[model samples]
Target: MRAILLIDDHAMFREGLVLALTQAAPDFTVHAVSNGSEAIAELEAHSGISVVMMDYYLPDVGGSALLRRLRQARPGIHILVLSASEDPDDVHAALSAGAQGFIHKSASSKTLLEALHGVIEGKQIVPDTYAAIDTNGRRLPQSDDAALLSALTPRQIEVLRLVCDGLRNSEISARLGTSEKTVKAHMTAILAGLGVINRTQAVLIARRAGLFGKPN
Candidate 1:
């Protein structure tokens, strides 16, 4: 049997989801909780839980921190975060902290189920908005671009531009005449300087800061 542990503070919505999930998947055993503490206790009590479906905002704990705690408790558990926020930072932070998928609360129930199934099957799921931003690469003001890019060193900027071009780390290393390890180190600094948690977010912020080109 597939088991799901859901953590959300809203009582009506949480109960509704539990009912909906059980009806949709007869083989699923869904357990519901309201906060971080209860979630921890439920997870500890139920060793068979395969998926954790949680709200990104909690009254008691921050999203990334709770995600980290859950991951530490169960290394192999699959986690999916649901939120009303479409913020790229939130999406990247959840993924960076260990969530396999992030779904906005505005999504249809069908979409949410599909994401859950995908995560359970070992797939990483990101929203269509993020995909669009990644593909289009929009530009912002020149001053803003200069200021954000200024945080990165010349080498870091070079590495980031290559990443924006979709080059793999190994390919970047070859192009820059550096080891893959060094490229990875540069990437870490780039992410920190850009205030993002992953390459996708880094690219989006770069585009927003006009790193790619002048505004269209």
Candidate 2:
């Protein structure tokens, strides 16, 4: 049986995941831990760890640093990040740090198990919303201009993303508690920054390039 290590900060989330995964993949032996530090300790105690499902919001250490440390310690261990949503930057950073894949938190138990298996088999899985970025055990972008995504500030990018989602300026302003004019201004800047002509171009660029919902 393949040995899987689970790392998360919340007791309930970790336990729920454990129960779900155990039911789905009965042949796997799962070793659960609460954080990155505990993961290292577990590794020291038991060197047979094969796969690690980690969350980014741990108290002791976040997923990025934890994966980096894990890669340094055990290069063969398959690392997958448990994330709430498809975040471009998070997926990029995790894979850049040597994670094998990303599993969305809201995925069904069966999907999670499948993702674990896929990771074990060395496939980089991305959710439906993030299409531009590709993974080959590491997140290497298809285009270097995609790196310019970081130029826009977080909130500006957030508003621009809503526009890409086809949300009107009024709806965005209401949801974000900002003025319609403010939303329009952000959209203008986003278009200019991306060298796009309009909102349609911006949205297409964002989705095609995996620009939205970067893990914070």
Top-scoring candidate (TM-score): 1
Each candidate structure's TM-score, on Cα atoms with residue i matched to residue i, is 0.65, 0.61
Candidate maximizing lDDT: 1
Q: Go through the candidates in order and give each one's C-alpha lDDT.
A: 0.78, 0.70
lDDT measured at residue 178 in model 1 versus the true structure, 0 to 100: 95
For residues 47-107, write the lDDT of model 1, one tens digit per residue: 9987899999999975989998887777678899989898877876786677877898887
Please give the distance, in angstroms, between residue 54's alpha carbon in candidate 1 and its true position after superposition: 0.4
Q: Estimate the overall C-alpha local distance difference test score of candidate 1.
A: 0.78
Residue 35 lDDT in model 2? 82
Score candidate 2 by TM-score against the native. 0.61
Give the C-alpha miss distance for residue 204 in model 1, angstroms.
Answer: 11
